[model samples]
Target: MNTNPATIRKGRKFEQVLEGARDIFLRDGFEGANVDDIARTAGVSKATLYSYFPDKRLLFIEVFRQECDRQTLAALDQIDLGAPVAEVLRQAAGHMVASFVNEFNQAVFRICVAESDRFPELGAAFYRSGPRRLHDELAGFLAGVDGQGEVAIPDAALAADQFIELCKADLYLRHLLRIDDSFAPEEIARVIDGAVATFMARYGVRT
Candidate 1:
């Protein structure tokens, strides 16, 4: 699959283009998104839009990238790195669940999966910006705390993955399967506490 789109060039109208693209993509999906509509909404000529993003696929990926970046930054800004271990996990897990269960993100995931065979880059891009980035950040946090003797994680990467998977126990899967949409705060708290206890049981220092 020639999923790799052309290089995205940044210009003065870049943000303007993305602003328009975001609205269109949200309203109409990747396949349904029209370049003409994108240009019209962005308030730029076809030539201008094409100059920044050579192909539709590239533009789509770039939009997802920017949105994912904003979500990640927002999550990170809420986290206090120096906080206690359980509290840190709670905050991170809450954000992770919220992001995964987001309607727009779910739509993007379905679209990317359905289209990935034709454009392999879409699925890979989402994985990179979403789960992979989350894993890396969690692993870094675990490693930092382990060094300080707060946790005993010898393999931070593995532990990080475990923690994330724990957060997804049933709610995340249910949402993806279309079995359910709304989850009460107590349900989320249950998963968070379960994850924290399961993790602490193994890695907590018994001092």
Candidate 2:
């Protein structure tokens, strides 16, 4: 098997382009960004940008995927599935809400909502790479914890999904709507507390 150095180089350059595009998108809304700006931001010429991404829409999708994957992994990877079931659930909820509230994440989310109809694929990519994957990971964790007698649930996967939805339902909605001035530390605490309470009511180990 022969390795193509050009292909390897192109792959690396594509990664760089995604990073540059993410930064640009964060600094400037999607409508304000362009291939010329992305190429300059990536430290590549127009030729290189077009080589990896023939169109701005394709490049935007790649950038959205890269960012969504990074955030989803970072949030899910921090959970310690070995911890006590209650702790694990709390940690997952805490991490998920915190990551979602992050300025960059919120910005990306706003951009998706603002342009969802115009760029439906970007929204679809985010949903698949982010929440869908997190749900899978959480389901696995919940199933493991259920087997350990830390929680009792008829459906671990459904419980995991519900747990996250409980945590973010109110807070996430407020943030998304820009109705909240800012997230006070105490507000996060309130969300966490409410989420944990709901989780325990549904799945706590009945002693």
Candidate 3:
């Protein structure tokens, strides 16, 4: 389809605001960030910013959605569906755990928890954008794998949730609590391998 120049320009400006708002939110947090600074950082007028996003919360949600789509959900597209099921699970679990344990993601999760009482929708918005979306994507993958007879998953969605939780294990909790700031590569690998093995033990088809 052909593009309109004005629409293209508007889209570019919208992206600029998103980038600026994300930086400000990450640096100053949801309550601390202000529209004036976001506009200034974005090199756009306050009117322009408001025209695109009427409120700070909407802008924050957009930023969060972009981050979730880019960092969390996009990884699923990289998996080779033709590969061995165990290998695919390991790769997918690795991506999920790695995304969850990162500093940026942990901060986002903390923001959701800390603000949920005041802005109850914030938590729901985050869940829909991040965890729920990831779960759905993984569920779809598992269903496809099951259809191929690679795994015997009677309930693909439940199995997806279980596998992701197994991948998180205690490491994600430790990171969230600031009890541990980092994990070794070997530790991550071990976690992914164990998660895959556990899932297979429960769901793999018999010979």
Candidate 2 structure quality by residue, lDDT tens digits, 1-207 = 222222223556778788888888888878888777888889988888877766666666566666667776776577776677777777877888886677777787778778899778667766776678778887887777675666787898898789878888677878777788468878887888888888888788877
Against the true structure, candidate 1 reaches a TM-score of: 0.90
lDDT of each: 0.87, 0.75, 0.84
Candidate 3 lDDT score at position 188: 89
Q: What is the Cα-based lDDT of residue 104 in candidate 3?
A: 78
Model 2 scores what on Cα lDDT? Answer: 0.75
Which stretches in model 2 have alpha-carbon errors above 4 Å?
Answer: 1-9
| Model 1 lDDT per residue over 88-120, tens place | 988888888888788878888888988889878
| Best first by lDDT, ranked | 1, 3, 2
* Model 1 CA deviation exceeding 4 Å by range: 1-6
Mind sharing the TM-score for model 3?
Answer: 0.89
In Å, residue 177's CA in model 3 sits off its true spot by 1.1
Query: Which prediction has the highest TM-score against the true structure?
Result: 1
Q: What is the lDDT of residue 53 in candidate 1?
A: 88
lDDT of 3 by residue, 11-98 (tens): 5599999999988988888999988999999999999997777767778777888898788646857877679999888888878888
By lDDT, the better pick of 2 and 3 is 3
